[model samples]
Target chain A: MAMQERALRTRKSLIHAAAAVFAEEGYVPSSLGTISKRAGVSNGALHFHFENKRALAQAVEDEAADAVRGLVRRADRTGASALQALVDTTCGLVDSLLDDIVVRAGFQLSAERALGPEARLLRTWHEWVEQALLGAEAEGQLAPGVSPDDTAAAIVAVTVGLEVLAGVDPQWLAERRIAGFWELLLPGIATEQVLASALPEAHEGRRSEAEEA
Target chain B: MAMQERALRTRKSLIHAAAAVFAEEGYVPSSLGTISKRAGVSNGALHFHFENKRALAQAVEDEAADAVRGLVRRADRTGASALQALVDTTCGLVDSLLDDIVVRAGFQLSAERALGPEARLLRTWHEWVEQALLGAEAEGQLAPGVSPDDTAAAIVAVTVGLEVLAGVDPQWLAERRIAGFWELLLPGIATEQVLASALPEAHEGRRSEAEEA
Candidate 1:
């Protein structure tokens, strides 16, 4: 492999290892030496990719942020309505939290008081959710009595709540759970016509996969 | 004060100090020395009250649990419908989370992996919510087609999510935020007649208090 490609692979591995450690042991207790060992890289190699633990954590969060953005983009690209995209994005994000250590750790790290001001992952998710609700309102997809701002707050809470709970039990990350949230919420927030067509699929396939485990 | 009364006061102070430290620094990093110093008691006194850091954390959690039970009891005594009691209890819990250091710390500790299974505060909250929804369903207070299980899951997610978010911003714990949640949710899950009567007070009184702050 080309040196540049190998360097990139090493960098990626280091980030993943760091994320696993941070998610399990938290930011304060996680050490660079342990991360290097988990990554199967020399201490010097780890340092070459990142200057310090803080920089490494920031990189993990940035990567996770990119994943969130990608989920939103993919959801939007499906040509779904704004409300549908919001539902799809939430499901996608929860799947990422369950399957991707980096994303899980990103959220876990963001909640850590030790990380202080640099933790912006939760805020980023909240902003996107707010924007989606506003778009739905502008398109007249929302129920007449629903306030976009208030709906946004509720959606963010449910999504973040699921994320927090999933940290303790992965069942909370199931697609069906997200679908269930929309099933109850859509009737209350979507216009009659939109509610008819915008209901999220119950995600039977993915839920079965969860049950198998 | 009598000898027993003075000892009880010392124990209470020690628990409070420990909670404050644990909430700020997290479980694994919190020190018995710091808790003792913060309590304004000698290390010997702290040890006499609690055997170790783990025991001190357990005491905090137990105290917080008692407070949660108290909130439910107060709500139950209002002679409201089961659903109404659930809403009132939620509002009361959020208020307690905002004002009580011990409750806040108990929740924080419950989420920390270092504390392990002994941290049952979140589970305790989740179980109560599930029971309340089940009771609502039995009373025919729930809207047709709404599953008590699913609705309970959503409510738990929103409550836990708000509590998690409130750790970063106390505004997330505002009565208005919890009120907003119920406002959006009550319409979707309550029966027509139940919905008419069960709408959580937009909590004008509490919202104004939050606004003043």
Candidate 2:
């Protein structure tokens, strides 16, 4: 049991180190030697845990995807309206991109052309946003002229934009920037009653409460 | 005069080839040799034109920026309302991304971590959007509660998102997709009297007219 626990810790450290390198250097230029050194693990240990650079990148991507899934799941569990849950998840996502290297690296790796299309964290997030909009549509939370598909596309684009911009400057993901996005978009997509409820600021207390729990 | 024209043509060909390679392989993996061969120019000729690979990439970025600047300028010349011009410019920009390899490559290079931060096409774009929004506010085209900064951020984010997503899938920059975005945003950001005129579709004829010119 002790050995297995230590192995798990080693794997986690290796993944974290890999993400940082990949995020900073991109997937093509990053070397496993540097990753293991950064992780403070032997090259043999790194090899034992992962087959090669691709596998290590895959692991990082998987972990990041899991974090995003968990973020979306948490927002879902808040029992807020679908649009509100989406707002919360998007806000959480930008926050994660700011604070979490793994998630940031996951997104960065997905953008690498050399890495091919194996990991599609952005598409996965887009699909989730689409489903949330669909749910909102079913709940009649959407405005009369709004189509779930169109709204989802716009939301996904903005969120992806923020993610990309945040790669260069975290200010792009600042609370004010995201809140401003919602402020501009919410009124166009939600009913007047649902509008106030779905505003990004409306979920601030809920986010903290959920965080505490 | 003939020698100068030939030299200019060689430079243009080299820049185009460089943009293609950089867009496909990214800035790090892209080779000057490949770019020159693709341009059908001897590497010596390429060297005579550009100091190094970085210079070549810089030239490509410069060409792309010029195209964008021209696009924005043409939109401005249309005598459209500020918001209308902004919408038209965005739609034109997306079209250019789809049709112009240099624009695509410029954006792709801007995203590369290996290339450093000397070239910031995205920042240039964000600034342009902000200025357009400020112009809209000045023209009384913005709806109540619409702050120029916030609207500009959202517009820039969505446009950047479309550009990034289009890198993977061109469909993300499709006409319907962009039109859908303006549809969702116009109602919220443009005043009621201005909304009808600033819509993306409303500018379609104007875009072709500008294109023909």
Candidate 3:
């Protein structure tokens, strides 16, 4: 059991290291040797944990997808309204993208074909968001005329886009810009009452919390 | 003058070759040899046209920025209404992303620190859109409560988001998906007539004839 735990830890370290290297140097240039070096593991350990560079990338992507899924699940459990939960989960995911190199690289990997696990994970995440939107629509919490699928897809696209933009230019990821995004997005999907009650307060709190953290 | 024209053609070929290589192999893994070979130019000619690989990347980014700027300018001139122009220009750019390797690479390059040119171009594009939105508002084409700057930023973000999504999955780039995006987007800023006009028309002729040649 102890050995298994240590192996898992080593695997996690390798994923984190690979994500950093992928984010910085990109997938093609980042090598297994550099990833292992960053993880402080021998080549043999890396191979034991991951069969190849592609497998290592898949591991990193899986870890990120799992983390994002956990976040959405938590928000779904806690949010006051279905719409609020969807919005909160999205905002939370965007916030996570700032701090989590794994999530960031997972997203970049999803854009490329080299990482299959991340791509599946991303598709699954979208399905989750789509389910949440449908639930909200069923509850009559969504604004009239909004298609849950389209809205959910747009929300995912916007969140990823914001992360990519933020990753490239931190200045644009400022409180004002993120706030601006929500301001536009919420009006399009949220019930007016929910927008009035939930969005403004949550957005404000999120801004200060992100700044402080 | 003939020699200058020959040099210009060589430069164009180098940029085209670099774009192809970058798209296929990504930034770091793509080498100058591959680019030169693809362009059917000697290494000396590649070096003559571009100082180095990074310089070639920059040139590709610059060419893409110019193309986008040209499209925006043309849309601005041809659009019958201010809001119409904004939407037309945006959709035009998104459509262009499907085929333009330079534009595609510009987006990929925007995620890296050493590739600031793409980020700068994106920012400039955002500013131009914002200005157009403000103009639309002044022309009384926007909704009363909408903030031009915020709305413009959101629209830009959505376009970028769609492009990124399409990059990963071409299905999202389909005409139907793009139309659905506009359906969601137009309601936020457009006057009623603009919304009506923004509805996607059925295919009437060769699609590229309406925009790209």
Could you say which candidate leads in DockQ?
1
| lDDT of candidate 1 over A7-49, digit per residue (tens) | 9999999999999999888888789999999999999999899
For residues B102-145, what per-residue lDDT tens digits would candidate 2 score against the true structure? 98888877756335764378778888999999898998888755
lDDT of each: 0.82, 0.81, 0.73
Of 2 and 3, the candidate ranking higher by DockQ: 2
Number of the predicted model whose lDDT against the real structure is largest: 1
Worst 10 residues of 1 chain A by lDDT: A202-211
Stretches of candidate 2 off by over 4 Å are: A113-115, A196-213, B113-115, B196-213
**Each prediction's TM-score against the native?**
0.92, 0.92, 0.84
Question: Lowest summed-lDDT stretch of 10 residues in model 2 chain B?
Answer: B202-211
Superior candidate under TM-score, 1 versus 3: 1
Per-prediction DockQ comes to 0.42, 0.41, 0.30
Off by over 4 Å in 3: A1-3, A116-118, A171-179, A190-213, B1-4, B140-145, B190-213
iRMS per model in Å:
8.2, 9.0, 9.4
Instruction: Write one digit per residue (lDDT tens) for candidate 2, span A1-213.
Output: 999999999999999999999888778878999999999999999999999998998888889899999998899888888888888888898888888999888887775533575438877888899999989889988876577888888888888788777767778888778777887777667776675453456334423433464
What is the TM-score of each candidate's chain B when compared with the real chain B? 0.90, 0.89, 0.84
